[model samples]
Target: METMRVIDKIRQLIPPLSPGYHKGQAGRVCVIGGSDEYTGAPYFSSFSALKLGADMAFVVCQPTAAVAIKSYTPGIN
Candidate 1:
């Protein structure tokens, strides 16, 4: 199926997970977006990067959105 092919490609791109790797060795991601009306977008974007094996994720957003984004998770920068 098409989905299976996509999954296979993704697996090929991701390096093997290993304890020998240090932080930031996996990857780093930066998401830029957020506003008074749409704060969750950036938060989810950055969070998704982390969930997908990124070691660090940073978000750039308005001050108001920054507060909400930070509240969502301390794991993100």
Candidate 2:
């Protein structure tokens, strides 16, 4: 059996960022989850993508939950 470091695996899977790349050239992600009873899960998923170099992250939840999610922060759309 053999093991590889997480960073090594990630580096092999993701392409390097190029200086000439423009917005969204890296990637875009959409997280769909959460509801009136649970909202943080969706927010965490969407924000996680943005933190990982995603150009944009969107969350699709119930209408009522949308308002709650949007109010939580301006970081995600």
Residue ranges of candidate 2 with Cα displaced over 4 Å: 1-4
Q: Write down the lDDT that model 1 would get.
A: 0.87
Query: Which candidate tops TM-score?
Result: 1
Instruction: Give me the displacement of residue 44 in model 1, in angstroms.
Output: 0.7
Query: How far does residue 12 in candidate 2 sit from its true spot (Å)?
Result: 1.5
lDDT tens per residue, model 2, 1-77: 13568768878988888999999889988788888989999988887888888887878889989988998896445
The positional error of residue 3 in candidate 1, measured at the CA in angstroms, is 1.8
For each candidate, the alpha-carbon lDDT, in order, equals: 0.87, 0.84
Cα shift from native, residue 29, model 1 (Å): 0.6
TM-score of every candidate: 0.85, 0.81
lDDT of 2: 0.84
TM-score, model 1 to reference: 0.85
